[model samples]
Target: MLENLLPPLNDHNLPYPDTIHPIVVHFVIAMVLFAVFCDGVGYFSRNSKLYEVSWWNLFFATISIFVAVMFGQIEAGLALAYPASESTLNLHTILGWSLSGIIAAITAWRYVLRLRDPKTLPIGFIVVGVVLTVLVCFQVYLGDELVWVYGLHTVPVVEALKEGVL
Candidate 1:
């Protein structure tokens, strides 16, 4: 009865053929990376002007990451993973949640720093930003593996599922 109300699954076995997670996540990834870049440049240039930009980017990223994670959880839950993709999918799920927490904590810490001294950001905070950038890069790699290698939600996989071959 519920299926009757829902839209028919598309070629990807998704209510809408395309996954929204990747689109939202790409924004989160870009914002976080850009925020880190702004911080690094601000630190090296000893310029306070970029701090505002960095703070705002991180602020938006903190919010966007949660949205990305929500879409990811929904899409991943709906994904029909083959045996080989299961471990990678599980790891991606775990890391996605972990990254969201880390981003939120760091954003909170940065907020406190902003409140303490709007004129200057701490060197330690910049260092942590560097670490966050590294982690984000790693997460991107995992996401690429899921899409490019494992082909999760790809046309062929979806077709196989439709054919009862998956």
Candidate 2:
């Protein structure tokens, strides 16, 4: 039924569509994880240098998130093979947008406060980054559920495990 609304699925065995399986999302996810670690270091060490590095990570994440959003949007149109896929896609889209907003707000806060006083920044970083990290974990789980449960998309590792594609 839902398949009637989508383009005919191509069975030519082409590598996954560019939109559904872009390489940049991989790099973006890595950057987000690295940013979380940097934030952790900054919070624990209370060092200005570490805090600055954390801010940079957040900045990178914000930019990458935008790119990921674009690719995800394009992929959504192509991957509507089942009804469950649509629900998972909607959930992922909401989580991604919320996470992007949180990361952007935190990055802006850190940047605007960077020069005024070094001491005040730690508490802000500790609070915001910690909260954002927790949210990121939740988003990660939503992403997993989208892929694993709904069968909306594929990652190389999962593709290998499920299909022996490696």
Candidate 3:
């Protein structure tokens, strides 16, 4: 199926060309994409099916994001073994956890509202999804600052340095 064809996470931690990091990055990007799509559907159609799908997407996305965050932490912990930058890593961790919590709350609200009358879905979806999008955007901006500006993740580089592979 088209769904199964999506790239998977790089659990093996291999040094080869391909890894799970890109997959995880895409996964987070997917959340933003889904949010946009769901919001559009809910806003334009106001259809129960669209509302249902949006809530389900948000619920699954929240769980997946938490998993990706754990992977980030593991990568950070490994980086800490050497001369890794602590400030950016700490910021990344804090922002990631905070965003995860917010997403979880939004997911809960979506589902709880979905269980009620279909009319209730739009108001909750608009309010919660809007709030979540703003928060997520802020978190993502912080993440970009951590990586591109500060270079928090030195794990792969450090490993390469140790092995003299580069």
Clashes of each: 0, 0, 1
Cα displacement (Å) at residue 41, model 1? 0.7
Tens-place lDDT per residue, model 3, 48-153, is: 5666566666767887887778777666554422234466567767877887787787777766766776454555457666666676666677667655654444
What is the per-residue lDDT of model 1 for residues 1-166, given as tens digits with 9 covering 90 to 100?
Answer: 8879978777776787599999999999999999899888998999888989989999999999999999999889878788888998899889999999999999999899999997798889989999999999888988999999888889898678668887
Residue pairs of candidate 1 with colliding backbone atoms:
none
Candidate 1's displacement at residue 2, Å, is: 2.8
List the candidates ranked by lDDT, beginning with the highest. Answer: 1, 2, 3
For candidate 2, the lDDT comes to 0.65
Q: Global lDDT of each model? A: 0.89, 0.65, 0.62
lDDT of 1 at 88: 87
- Model 2 residue 156 CA deviation in Å: 14
Prediction RMSDs, each to the true structure: 1.3, 6.4, 8.1
Model 3: runs farther than 4 Å from truth?
Answer: 1-22, 80-85, 119-124, 152-166
Question: Per-residue alpha-carbon lDDT of model 2 for 1-166, expressed as tens digits?
Answer: 9758656533322234434434656666666677667667766776557666666777787888888777776666555435545666787788877777777887787778776764446555666666776777777777777667765544453344346543
Model 2 alpha-carbon drift over 4 Å, by segment: 1-22, 118-120, 154-166
